[model samples]
Target: MIRHLVLFKLNEGVERDDPQVVAGAEAFRALGDRIPELRFWECAWNISDRPIAYDFAINSAVEDTAALQRYLEHPAHQAGVALWREFATWVMADYEF
Candidate 1:
């Protein structure tokens, strides 16, 4: 399986309650049900107060590289990414397990 992880930090001055941030978060949350390639999915806001913690996270898995590719290319995923691009910076990693 391929595990895909992403961590997002909201842009400076952007609050969690901001409409764009909320919409961007909801967009990612909905991907679990919208994408067929996902074998597992978990996404949520960070509960930590630590300075190093990211504001949001996404932990998901797929069957293989091809499945992972499909997830990344999926229209729903693309839309979510587009929304996030406006208010956040993120990092991602994918590895086979």
Candidate 2:
């Protein structure tokens, strides 16, 4: 099993409170249902880690890193990333067992 997580901070030019950000989060949450390899997925808008520098985050679980790699290269993910880039300023990550 593997846990892959990413955190995104949208540019100041984009609205942090925008509905689409929320929508995108929900979209990510729904991917586990859409893609079988994804054991679970969750997207969050706020974090209590007050000193951190991320605006939003995506946390997902997969059967393995191979599944994650396949998911990363999938067309649906490409489409989703394209949509996500519109609101994202910088994206960061943390991946592990």
Clashes of each: 0, 0
Measured by TM-score, the strongest candidate is 1
Backbone clash pairs in model 1 (N, Cα, C under 3 Å; residues 3+ apart or in different chains), count: 0
Task: Give model 1 RMSD, 1 decimal.
Answer: 0.5
Ten contiguous residues with the weakest lDDT in model 1: 20-29
Candidate 1 on 1-97: residue-level lDDT in tens?
A: 9999999999999999999999998999999999999999999999999999999999999999999989999999999999999999999999989
- Which residue pairs collide, candidate 1? none
TM-score of every prediction relative to native: 0.98, 0.77
Q: After superposition, how far is residue 44 of candidate 1 from its true place, in Å?
A: 0.2
Candidate 1 residue runs with Cα over 4 Å from true position:
none
Residue-level lDDT of model 2, residues 8-76, one tens digit each, is 877666765688766666666667677777777877776565766677777888887789888888776
The all-Cα superposition gives candidate 2 an RMSD in Å to the true structure of 2.4
